[model samples]
Target chain A: MTVSIIRFGGSNCDRDAERALEHLGIDAEIVWHEDGLPEETSGIVLPGGFSYGDYLRAGAMAARSPIMADVREAAAAGTPVLGVCNGAQIGCESGLTEGAFTTNESARFQCEHVYLRVERDDTPWTAAYDEGDVIEIPIAHGEGRYEIDDERLAELEDEDRVLFRYCDENGDTGPDVNPNGSKHNIAGVLGDRETVAVLMPHPERVTLPDVGPTDGQGVLRGFEAAENGA
Target chain B: MTAYTATVTVRLKHGVLDPEAETTQQALERLGFELEDLRSADRFEIDIEAESAESAHERASEMAERLLANPTIHDYDVEVDER
Candidate 1:
């Protein structure tokens, strides 16, 4: 029962995710994209980096990789999948999740700590935190802004698929607080099921105590919860 | 088989915000140029050999649908010509 982190051609965060999971006492391994999911895989993480050098667009190439079809099938079978930063873009691009993470509103690569308000607590990803709990995570990407047709965006919101939104330290959300021009300050979202989530923030960056913040521990802990049938 | 060059142009759908284009427009304005607005598109020229120009067009259209453009925010057109 190990979490398999898919390492694409340019995935730089696979090691980070592996260490983060290990620090939580969860068994995890970095699997190359071509090798396919291991038989013992119990969870998946699409860690972040400039896959394919951001050619065409961020996550566009890797989304079409041969392995994603298997990933989709596993997710459908109730395997918990978490995508962070560039992983968020790939999730959307591959249809593992909804919407797209396009260029930032500022049109520049922005890297900083941002506050995320947990939109729900029942899902495996957010079960460790109370609803509206503010957690700090570091986001580093140029194409981190989320985009979807207005009609779909509204429908997604109505369905409560949104998992996290950028907010101030106090958990108040507004355009001013949105790090990127994500619709309604959206920073993370769920798939049709709560077990699958994609967010444009690096939970691994904050999971280690050697680092400054520890707010991201819950997101990584989600793997254990999902495996335990939470 | 006929040799063809398929031109696929992908552009952001109208009304979708494109900050890269906006930033480029701002840069042009800073350069003392006058323009009402600006938009951008990516044109991919694919060379392929197929049974006919129609087949070439079809292949390029599929490519655009699958990789060249994201339907969520992009609209694309494909044109094929004998090379």
Candidate 2:
């Protein structure tokens, strides 16, 4: 099963995602947004970058592109979909996920490695990790802060849709370690289905051994799990 | 049909954190500007041919709803005038 990585104009990380997935033994193809999803698509990856120069808002323009309709349909069909970094922004903007990733609390671009505490281990994305496991991943963005209505956020928590929270190396979550001041330190979240996920941190950035850490391998392995029907 | 201009303004909700605005406010303070508070909004003007000013306003409002503004963190208003 080949994972289709949607590449919109100004998307710069599509190649990185492809290389990372290829390194992990997963077949991946970078599909230009205008070209549409390949008919053989088995999975979807919305890789990161400043789409449309981040005009109007980060991911806003790309989210409205015609290709997204197919992506939404694929997700609804239970196809595994992962959105990373700017992809996470597009996911939220397109209503594929809850909440919006707004301007960082710091009001500037932040590029660094941060710790993420796995909120659960049952979903495909976290199957390789244990609950509360701390993984180091790099985040690069100017607008990655997550925002949602207070009551809706409470409901999201109640539904246990949170996938990961920014935390310390010891797996402790708090505002101190919330790099972007996302609500409740949420670094990632599952869409309506656990099969669909989005996060600001670049798991692919950590998947390769040459990159220093394999902590993100577990996350990318979600595609492998889907391909193998695990 | 009459030509009209629709002005749309989008701003963050009252309670949501606006880091850019906050930073700008800080910068102004550092520059010795006197201001109790500062807020920022994005404004867009669209020229269109519509049946009436009301129709232009309606179309602009719809644009705001669908693309110009996000409901989660922003509030927007649309105004139209005949050109």
Fnat for model 1 comes to 0.83
lDDT tens digits by residue: candidate 1, A144-199? 98999999999999999999999999999999998889999999999978899999
* Chain A TM-score values, per prediction: 0.99, 0.98
CAPRI classification of candidate 2: high
User: lDDT tens digits, residues B1-83, model 2?
Assistant: 99999999999999999998899999999999989988999999999999988889999999999999999899999888888
Taking the tens digit of each residue's C-alpha lDDT, what string does model 1 give over B23-70?
999999999999999999999999999999889999999999999999
Chain B TM for prediction 1: 0.96
Q: Which ranges in model 2 have alpha carbons more than 4 Å from their true place?
A: none
Angstrom error at residue A23, model 1: 0.5
DockQ of 2: 0.93
Model 1 / residue B21 / CA error / Å: 1.0
Q: Report how far off residue A170 is in candidate 1 (Å).
A: 1.2
Give lDDT: candidate 2, residue A193: 87
Clashing pairs in 2: none
Per lDDT, the best of the predicted structures is 2
Candidate 2 local Cα displacement, residue A110, angstroms:
0.4
Off by over 4 Å in 1: none
